[model samples]
Target: MKVKLTIKLLISMIIVYYITMTVYVVLNLVIYNSNITFGEKVFSVSFNISKFMEPYIEDLEKGNDFSLDDNNINKLTQNNIWIQVLDKENKEVYEVNKPENIPNSYLTAELIEFIQDPWGSSAPTTISTNNIAKGNENYTLLIGFPIDKIFRFKMTLTDESFKYHISIIIFSLILMTIVAYIFSRNLVKPMVSVVEDIDDLKNGIYINKKNKQGIFKEVSKNINNLSLILKENELQRKEADKAKEEWIANISHDLKTPLSSIKGYAELLKGDQYEINIEEAKRYGTAILDNSNYIQELVNDLSLVYKLKNKVLPIKFKEENLINLLQESIIDLLNNSKYSNKEINFNYYDDNIILDCDKKYLKRAINNFIINSLEHNSKDTIVIVSVLKKENNINIIIEDNGYGIKEEDFKNIFTRYYRGVNTSSAYNGSGLGMAIAKEVIDCHDGVINIESEVGLGTKIIIVLKN
Candidate 1:
């Protein structure tokens, strides 16, 4: 990017430089070859003073009157110029459109001084003098131009000096061009890098090239940070997509199993060839109902998780006794005959610790944690639930001395559809329990933290505002 931009800039500067040199050469030609100044070209005068007075100078040399025609007089007046003719005696022989301050007679010394320093005089006019002679009688013709219209400067230069000055000017211009090019290149270098980096980002390529020294240092740092964040997000999205695929497969299998059972039992009940008794029919009906309920529970979990994730789940916040809410969740779990043999303990000193929360979702989250402990461990494994008030916050801790979570699983514990590696085949689940619980806690503006070591135990802490 830098190379391309530098080349383009160098080309542009060269083009501009050459064009300027061309204009300079053309203007020099125009200035030296004509009496008309550059600014006067568009509105050129009919004739210049030197050309107009040339014919009359011959007449004055032959001893004729240095007089002008009406047309010449009008031309001189319009161009703001005056002419004076002086004869041998230093007396002004003829004058046209001359200023009042100009004396009709002059001493030779005065005439020489005025001619030498015309601009230094009070009149401050630019004067041009020409001498004409006939039969040893000499005459001078003087032309005076407005000071504002003409400027005169006298310069003395030899060939060598002129060449040396021209060489110096050319060298300085070259040096200036080189310096300007270098400065502009440096200025645009960082910008080129930035634009290229942005293009790479647009193509989903994230690179962290740190520019530590330059005006763009901060800009480079910010872009690199953004790249890192985007890279991380991209990785997360891929992981989520993989997990989603796994979840769909698992859900399909789970649904198929219950559906197959329900279908089988219904078929058995409907078979006329098999002479089924009322007791047998009742058993078949109960089996079918159980499978149906299981399917419905799975569906409900799926729906609830989607709502929670989308932040569309309505939460009815109200003050409730924390102790009672936890006890009720424990009792509900204990009421399940499958987990009745599980050893669970609830410990709390405060019975009236009040909290503002969505009772339904909060209770569901708590039940999920408790059930997770019960289902994942041996029946003899001890589980403890405790609630404590810390300053203005409430902490509910669930601990268990069970086969703790593996490190790999622990990292993604709350990720949707991520069942633990040690998940039991006997106890099937939708794999949305932990994810749902997390979402529920988040909706209540709460935090959940977990600490677990393999084979020792797992401790889960839920903190909520009081």
Candidate 2:
């Protein structure tokens, strides 16, 4: 996303320069160095003529009868070359009928021979050489040939090849510039669309449809994902607001019934026309007190649920024996007056399960499951709580023979303030019990699962890691 145009352009330019430089070097080497035989042919012909006249130098130095053959020498130096032979005294012993129009520099030269034969550029016909033979006396041989014209011809061809390579390099640079522009444009296009979407979002315009492709396809995908998340959150928020209003209405209705009954009975006692027994009066007062306490417990549970949802409550996790905790929680639940009349069956297996957990939070989670069962189950039905082992985890189950939840509502049963169809008629409790249980499980990085069939039974399973 942060890719800069200048960086892209720089890289493209470097590639173009490298390719052009490589092609230029290759063409130059091929035209000059690779053609070994071309330079050698000129050298070979010049060397042959010199080699053929080697015996004449010895003959003239020894004062033997020697012929100075100008016609043959003239024929040998036909190819734009000036040939000269010098004697032992450094005097010119032989000269070809060289062209007068030839440069004067070629005609006047002193020559010395190297022990190692000159190779490459130096071995060409431009070289001048002198050879000496030492025995009882010293004899010398010198020869010169001008080859500047051949060098000029080679340079001209090289210049032409370089000119062609320069033109190609210019065209290639232009092509690379075009390619870089297209590539950078394609890469940035999608991001531009995402930026525009952000501007729309800021102005309170939520566009959920994803309508972009190709170069900016990934950007579009990310935008679509963000849009979906926002939409889901908006829906949940609206649902929570509606639930809040319903909860207030339900709480008002519930409080009104108990308060109205207490008010009516108290008025009867205050009226002198009504004959009220003292025991009956006490019973009425106890009923009012019981309902008030229920309200208080309901309010307390609701408060805790809110804290858990907002992450205001902190959990203290530790390693403990889950079996002891489960048994203790059930005993505590049964001690309550509301659940004392309900038949409860406990099935515990020694699964050797030990887990790191917040003891109080997990106990609350289990208590929520028990309370849910008590609230929904039929009178005289037995509720079962069991513990078992799974792979590196402990599975605790609380089951009741109750009218089970609908299949459609299974996934969202643990959500906060989610009351089912029979909630208003069958139960009188805040809808945050299961939500609190879910929060506790999530804190332990565990999971909760439920299995149920309508009008048969409901099973709640909590899995915690060991």
Candidate 3:
């Protein structure tokens, strides 16, 4: 039979107590059988009995008119005490019971030798005193107490006291047993419940918040925390799985679309036997080049996505004057022919802001934002770039007065491969630009957010710690 821990502990304690109590009782039995008790050792029997008969002993000692009364003699004999007196001739002068264990006459020297080795000759069952001399040496007194008789009397008194002592011991045992049971139950129950909860978790059964409290509350909290972490991981796993499938589908369609165009235009250019118009051939050549560049962009965006996500791409960080970095980025963007027809503006404070950032990655992110504005908006739109110190933070604000984004597409704007509903094909762009830009800013510990409304304008703001 499988025994529970509580039962086992309770049984073990009971057995221990039983063994202890048995040892106690057996030790007491051994002591009583040996005709010894703590009381006898502490106060000799003669002292006790002499106190009860003190007046009589004192009178005898003074040689006064003292003789054992019949009643007193009877009391002494009943209590196993025998008294005797002898003269110088060694003949008994007075005696009680005249115990047969000793001779009626004794030489003083012989009595002295006997006293030294009294128990040697399987001595009298009684404890005896050697001769005690009278002042004139005319008489000697002797007394004896029987060993068995003394133990009998001692047992009677002990039986009387055992009533209270035994009661207390028994009560203590019962109380201790109850306490042991309760302590064992309290200790084991919570652990058992926690183990059960852990088993449930192992079986994929979720434990509710309500289950996360007990005597072992810290263990419960850790288990609950494990559940929370697992739940989060499960959610992230599902998201990554969905994103993977979508990415594959999008990449396949996007790759084939440009490749099919390039192939068709190249075939058209290859068939020049019909004397194709020069302008028409040049147009086909342009189409092929555009498709090829778009394909290359797709490949590059995909590569950046994985590299940034894993943080394997190295970032070189350095302290830079924020104003100087912004001016440099603006100059590089102005040199681009794509934004030649677009209006650009810069506004900043005269006070320089110091920041730690990866200049290359930061410039790449800002370039994406500017390119997005130019490609997604109408020509001649005014794009404003501003830098301002907000408290302890630096704000790099990019605002474009251009055709704003549709509200529904805002949530997916930064998602990889998410091309908005109105994205243009003029730049042969991949939908990964904003996603890559967001990753770059995030890696730099910066914040980038966009605000826009349909037909109004779009604002892109980047906040950096100073």
Predicted structure with the largest lDDT when compared to the true one = 1
lDDT of 1 at 67: 57
Task: List, residue by residue over 1-466, the lDDT tens digit for candidate 3.
Answer: 1139789878988898789989999977676445455465423333344345464455466654337767767767666667777677876777776567677777878666544444543445444444444565656666666655443211444775888788998899889999999987877787777888788778876656655456689898888888778777777677657766776787787778888988887777787566778898888888888778778777777788889989887888899887888788888878766556568888987657888998888888888888888778777678899988987788888988888988656877787766665554344456788999999999888898789987888999998887
lDDT for every model? 0.83, 0.68, 0.74
Which digits, one per residue and each the tens of the lDDT, describe model 1 over residues 1-466? 6877887887778888889999998976775556664356322433354665676565556544455667667767887888898888889878889999998989999888787788767687888889877566677888887767765678888999899999999999889789768976997788888888888788999888866468888888888898899989999999999998998998899888989999998888878889999999898888888889889988899999879878799899999998999999998888887777777899999899999998998999999998888778776788899998999789999999999998878888899987776654377788889999999999888999899998998999999987
Provide the lDDT at 380 for model 3: 68
Which order, best to worst by lDDT?
1, 3, 2
Model 3 TM-score, 2 decimals? 0.56
Q: Considering summed lDDT, which 10 consecutive residues are worst modelled in model 2? A: 107-116
Off by over 4 Å in 3: 1-189, 203-207, 211-213, 271-278, 318-343, 349-357, 372-382, 389-393, 401-431, 443-445, 449-458
Off by over 4 Å in 2: 1-195, 203-211, 259-276, 314-321, 335-337, 351-359, 423-426
Of the two candidates 1 and 2, the one with more favorable TM-score, higher being better, is 1
